[model samples]
Target chain A: MNEFLEQFLVEARELVEQATADLLALEREPDDRASLDGSFRAFHTLKGGAGIVDFAAMAHAMHAAEDVLSTVRKGDRPVTPDMIGECLTCLDQVVQWLDAIEDSGELPGEADAEADLLAARFAARAAASEGAKANSPVLGTAPSSATALAVLQEQIALLAVRGEGLEGRIASAGRLAANIFRHLGRFDDAERIAGSVSESLAGLDTTSIARSIESALERLADKLSPSQIAPVAVRPDPLSRTLRINAERVEALVSLTGELTVANNAIGHIAMLAQEGDNPLAAGIADEHRKLDRLIAGLQRAVLELRVLPMRGVFQRFSRLVREMSESLTKPVRLTIEGEDTHADKAIIEMLSDPLLHVVRNAMDHGVETCAERASAGKPAIATIHLRARREGEHVVVEVEDDGRGIDPNRIRKTVVERNLAAADAVAGMSDEALVDLIFMPGLSTATDVTDLSGRGVGMDAVRASVERLGGRVQLETRLGSGSTVRFLLPFSVMMTEVMTVEAGGQLFGIPLDAVVETVRIPREEIRSVGHAHAFVLRNRTIPLLGLGQTLGWAKVESDSDATVVVASTGGLLGGLEVDKLGSRMDVMLKPLEGILSGIPEIAGTTVLGDGGVLLVLDVKELLR
Target chain B: MALTILVVDDSKLARMAVAKVLGGLCPDWTRVEAANADEALAAMHEKTPDLAVLDFNMPGRDGLDVAAQIRGLRPSMPMAVISANHQKEIVDRAHALGAVFLSKPLTEPALRDFLAGAVRQIEAGAA
Candidate 1:
């Protein structure tokens, strides 16, 4: 993933968690002010986030939810449990779609059904409210010069509650409203309110309201004039959201990253050839290499960072998620989230939305204890789920922890044994930690009954696998009586890494810096070919030598050159990449090739050299498989 | 009345899509198609259109050149330019040439809304 996308994944995961918890809480207490405020804030924050990240679909949906919340907050309407339920369902769909987008660049086919249902419900609610107001004027009708005095009185009364700073402006609005009423020949009512209008207007903040009243009076006077034979049409305001950028600019960035690599390699070669003795020329070359390396690294970082987007883009769906999930589960779990300003690769964030939701739902349905249970357990009646994120060295660590009935190891152990995953005898020898780890095993579940939330069978293993695929690791740690914490450690960015240069099938390839554990040059006599797979016993460990050419469907040939075996680790498994040469570590941008060219399993992407030659960056994780 | 319209484009798909949307919205309009500025001018002499929707970029004569020429010939004629890319430079140029700007890929609602606004402005100005 790119920097923007990577940051987005980390941030989006947190937002999803918050949204789910809030939704669950809102279900329990629909009229709770804090719950309502939090749900609205989550939606608003998610909408703003989605807008910046160009997640238009999520932004559009969140915007609709925001409209509902804004209307509710303005005291114009009430949020019902059913409405919250629908919103949470929408959230689930969006989360699933987001996950789909993360794993695959597009949403799955079923996302449209959820979007349509939510949109229709949103539209129906808006329409119903609009129809009610249209049928009943209630305390207010559309403001006109004839009703301006009443409008002024209402404003003055409202503003008076807030105190005196805006009194002067409010008084002016009252006067303007009276004038408009007089112009419209409603002088009888106008004259009655004219006495107190000035004092009332003075006690309000009516700058814009006063101006609008004045404009209305002017228009009314014009309309009443006998000389006005034809109606004059007012022009419409210009509104647009379109921009243009040069296509060449993006291509230029790609070329610059390539040039940096060439210059970097040349500097290294010059430094290596310097005199044996400590000389000024030799030191100068070394110094130049260091400076050039930093310069290139900075340039690469700057270019890659362009793709970084804030996590808020994906978080917007969470607000609706919270609204939906809270009602569905018949539980109240208020989500408190922070650190949304975190940025990451847009692609990574887009993919992160779903996995985050699964984790959240899993927490709410299975992790967080019920309100009565929590109170009986000497904890607060409501569960508090916290999601916190921050950068650690070259990776971003995102943790989702809830204060609830912690993971029950015995429950998981029984489930695993009943499912025939492990022998009953073996369960005794296994530690509590080992028993708890079973929750993440594929097709494992501890829920006694299957419901809409959790218990349907898919568990934490899917999330763990997806996180690992993004060059990250997922670890689960829980206290038996406390709560469970799932921490994901992912690289800050994926485009640029310190890769070890290796030659395979006589072609140069790069192994990711994190994947390579060690590189050893073993004598050819020690290498033995076993059933088409090359194996070498390094020290005591038997490692299989994965042929880069044979595995990738490239032309295979026998070579006389000494082999350099690079040991790499992928998904807790060790493998070796046998190559003819081992070059020094070099930094290069990972550029995914166009279309089907990138479909090659062994190749992660392609990078360009200063000389314009393409270097295939090998996917060490994929290669090991 | 059969309202005459000038359609400018370089991309075949974009032109077809825009035409289809226009046809769907205002089926009475008579469309005059042009691949570039040179073709647009040749078609312009054959008949003067009531309105023109020009594409900003093309190999021979870009949308801006054609819009400028239309402005010189008939300043009051309703003219709008469609652009795919979002660049202030091109938008400013279109504005300077006295044309409404619409960015693609043009959905049905977007196209209809732009046309409605443009038509109202044109008819209001004429009145």
Candidate 2:
């Protein structure tokens, strides 16, 4: 796309989002003038953006919405649910058109029909409100100048009062008169008012200030006609200090940084080889390698920082969704988002959108009860779904919690048995906690009838899969009658993985350092065999042991007099993996297994080693399972 | 002779918009841009400009506050205070500081009028 169109798309999308938020806020608080003005300005700017892009249809639609908003701003029409809905619908159409333009890099050819339909709907709403306004004797009939004059007169009366704060009142009245005159384009009258007010203030003469303001008010009443004092046209706020960089460009930079890290690793390896030789230059080469490593690390950190973005972009869309769902389901729902400014990798944020959609849809469809049902059950009629994101150590934790009907373990248990996902006797013995976990099993939905919204028997499982694909885990916590919170614990960033390379049975493997607790060596006599598996004791705790070579189906080599074990922890379980040697730690960009290697339970992914060899990174949880 | 104009706004986009308009109106006029009150004050200290345009709504000190300080330094300097918020208080403050109030998004004709008035003020002060 040309730069101008691209800029327009970015700006127009932001305006749409802003307008949607403001309209929703207005729906919640009809008297919120800030939201009213914000919506008006957003639509006005959106229309400007459309005009710049030469998209007349979008401009026409936006102009209609702006006109209705203008009426609301003027207090001629009160904000109604129907009006907010129409404005939201208009925004929805604009979003669709924006999507089309982004995809095709040009204005959509067939947008006129949709725009015309939306514009007509908005115009009808405006006209209907105007008709009602016309019938009312108190509204839309008084001239705005009369209101300004009334305000000035009130100020004059206050100034005339000989109160303790009389001086303050005089100053305020003087300011009011000056503003009134300036707004009327009578600059000289405004200057005269200002001059008199300042001179009076210097002399502490409140009467003179009031007299000057009264005369200015009289002049304004005579000269300022109704047509002269037009309503102030709301404009956009100051632009934020942000740059719109293409996501692909950042991804490309990440890839290049990863390549540089690999190259630096190769240099370190060469330095090691040189150190092994008896040459004077070996020390110099090693020094250069250390310097290069530091530079590469800084570069990697900067590149990763570039990919970090706040969670607001993903969280802001849920407000509109909840509103629409509340309307359709006949349930009053409120969505509260917290910690949306928590930063996470852009890739993680993008991948979270679909899974979050599924979870939120499920929350609305199956979790929240109808308003009538809620009121009868001694709960508030309005259901609140709280979407929160926060940084916890090296993880970005997202939670979608709803105050509604919690997931019933009994329902899940029955569904599990009916779906044949688990044996009846086994499910009967399972605890309620375990039974609730069965919801994550595919095709184990408890809803009797499938709804178009969420209960398609494919939501929770997909949510788990998507989160796990990012090396994250999904957890659910619920009470029988309270509510359910679906928590996703995800890695802060997926671009790089830090692993400790270990030599096992003459072959090398990579273990994610996050799971590495501690390594120890124990005498062969101290190890015991139990049920054909070896076990060992470390720090007075018994940890099961697995030979990496045997697990990979390679020929097992006899251990030396002492066994070297790498202790790894995953999913609250600790296991010692027997290795021949512990290698150095390094950062690598993990590539997901492709083709036949994909879906391997024990192997998580592969990374390129300094020797140009592939290192299989283990999924410690799956490996121990 | 060409004259230099100082434009101060917290938003880079707002500064660019003002600069673009000024460039079109007075191609020979040099423009100096500042993002905040401190930068604007510093620019004035370095070299005073013939005309100034300041955004009323900024981060630290508002445009009128800065205008008041400029008025202390050069009492007769012609200035315009620009803001999207057309509140009466802001306009009154701008007028008290001897600056014209211009609503945003600023139009070509409105800016042209302000510049013409400013030029006449500078000429009158020189005479």
Top-lDDT candidate index: 2
* lDDT digits (tens) for residues A504-579 of candidate 2: 8778889999889998988999999999998998878888999888898888888557988899986546899988
Question: What TM-score would you give candidate 1 relative to the actual structure?
Answer: 0.47
The chain A TM-scores for the candidates, taken one by one, are 0.54, 0.65
Q: Which ten contiguous residues of candidate 2 chain A have the minimum total lDDT?
A: A226-235
Model 2 CAPRI rating? incorrect
Name the 10 consecutive residues with the lowest summed lDDT in model 1 chain A.
Answer: A228-237
TM-score of each predicted structure versus truth: 0.47, 0.58
Model 1, A245-321: lDDT tens digits are 23357447746776666767666766776746555699888887889888887777776566555555555455445
lDDT of 2 at A160: 67
How much is the lDDT of residue A528 in candidate 2?
90
